[model samples]
Target: MSYVDGFLLPVPKKNLAAYKKMAAKAGKIWREHGALDYRECAGDDLKTAFGLPYPKLMKLKKGEVPVFSWIMFKSRKHRDTVNAKVMKDPRIQAMCPDPKQMPFDVKRMCYGGFKTLVKA
Candidate 1:
């Protein structure tokens, strides 16, 4: 079974373009480094439900929304290897060229690595 890594964060409206550019580069890097798939989805359709662990209601600014992304790998070992390379890649390093350009709050970001429990 494949392994999946998930991430969720809030992105500033003014930084959406910058975030997209960085995400594109990151997706490519993940693929090249051995990820089966790398996908980023702007959080538009998220809805609240009882007892959900994720934020039921995102506290958005005047024009901001949450963002979510995931990367699929053949297994945990493959994910580890790919992540290592991606982290070391110059392209990934350049994504955050300046502190002010970072789109999301790194401290508030949520991430987890999961083992596939069921698949179609």
Candidate 2:
């Protein structure tokens, strides 16, 4: 079975474009580094319980937007190995000018290792 690393975060509405750009760059780098899939999705067609909005769960303040994304790997072990290499890849490091300016809050980011149940 495949493994999926899922992420849900709140992106500042004002920084959405900048964030998308950064995500696109990272997605390409991740794919090149052996990710099976790298996907970034903005807030659209989202539905939550009447009292359980996504941003509210993230403790987002006023004016933020939700961005749900994930990266897929062949398996959990593969995910671990590829992530380690991606972190150390020189090409990826070269593109990171300021780690402090990352589009989303690292502390607020949520991720989980999931086992895929079905696939077409």
Candidate 3:
């Protein structure tokens, strides 16, 4: 089974383009460092009647959008190894030129690592 890193964040609509650009670069870096897959999806259908909608789940404010993202690895150890290298990559530094200048509010971002229980 594979390991995964997941992220959920709120980004203002006005910054979506910038955010996408950053994510694309980040995905490339992760891939180069051995990530099996990387995906960053913007919220299109945020409302639902049966459960907590993404907007609500993220406590999104007016004009802010929700983004759900993930990266896959061969296993937990592989994920750690890849991430360690990725953190030190100059590509990552270039991707995030200034943490203080990031597109969205870092305080609102939620992230975690997971051990996949099942895969199809």
Candidate 4:
């Protein structure tokens, strides 16, 4: 089964473009290091009729927006290997010397590893 890493964070509303640019660069690096796929999505239509929405999930604050992201790998071992390389890549280090300085609130970001249950 495939493995995945998910991330949900709060980015400042005005930093959307900057966040996308950063994600694109990082995604390319992940792909180069063996990630099968990388996706970054900005929240829209936050109001949900039923359960919790991104805004609520990340506890989005004033002037903030939610970004939902994921990275795919063939398996957990592959993910670990790819991530180790990605972390050491000079480009990534230069891009985020201080995670807190990025366009989003790193401290409040949510992240987790998961094993895919189904695909269709």
Candidate 5:
């Protein structure tokens, strides 16, 4: 099984492009630091008939949408190692010198590390 770090957040529609640009750079940094895979996806069809929809779950405001992202690694230990290097990376520091400057609210972002339970 592999390890994964997942993230879910709300980003303003007007900031989506900026968010995508930032994510692309960040993904490259993660991959360069040994992440097996990295992906960032924006929500498209959020309206649903059943269960809690992302817009509701995230309490999305006008012109805001949910974004989901994840990074894969060989294992939890590997994830930790790669992330440590990524944190120390100068590019990352320059990209996000102040969390408050991010396109979305960092405080509203949800993140968790998971152990893969099943794979086909």
Candidate 6:
């Protein structure tokens, strides 16, 4: 079974472009380091009557929108190996020397690792 790392966060509308650029660079690094897949997607239609909407769950501000992302690996061990290299990558360091300077709020970001239960 494959392993995956998921990310969800609220990004200010004004910084969406910058966030996209940063994500693109980060995605490239992950792929180079052997991640099976890397994807970043912004919220399109968040309003809904069923379940907790992302805007509410994330406590999105007036101009903020949710961004969902994931990185796939062959397995948990593979993910660990690739992530270690990505963390040491110079490009990643250059991209965010200080977590405080990230385009979005790191404190508000949600992240988790999951084992694939089903894939078809």
Question: Where does candidate 1 stray beyond 4 Å?
Answer: 47-62, 97-100
Candidate 3 similarity to native, TM-score: 0.95
**Candidate 2 residue-wise lDDT, 78-106, digit = tens:** 99999998889887786666766777776
Give lDDT tens digits, candidate 1, residues 50-92.
Answer: 5553444455555666888999999999999989998899988
Pitting candidate 1 against candidate 4, the one with the higher TM-score is 4
TM-scores for candidates 1 onward, in order: 0.85, 0.85, 0.95, 0.96, 0.98, 0.98
79 Cα displacement, candidate 6 (Å):
0.3
Give the alpha carbon lDDT tens digit for every residue of 1-120 in model 5: 999999999999999999999999999999999999999999998779999999899888899989999999999999999999999999999999898899999999999999999988
Reference-based lDDT, each prediction? 0.83, 0.84, 0.92, 0.92, 0.96, 0.96
Tens-digit lDDT track for model 3 on 1-120? 999999999989999999999999999999999999999999998668788899877888999999999999999999999999999999887777776799999988999999999787
Kindly list the per-residue Cα lDDT of model 4 for residues 7-69, writing each as its tens digit. Answer: 988889899999999999999999999999999988888899999887777777999988889
Clash total of candidate 2: 0
RMSD of each: 2.3, 2.1, 1.0, 0.9, 0.6, 0.7
Clash pairs, candidate 6, are: none
Q: At residue 114, give the lDDT of candidate 3.
A: 99
lDDT of 6 by residue, 18-82 (tens): 99999999999999999999999999988898999999999999999899999999999999999
TM-score of 6: 0.98
Model 2 TM-score (2 dp) = 0.85
Question: Which structure is stronger by lDDT: 3 or 6?
Answer: 6
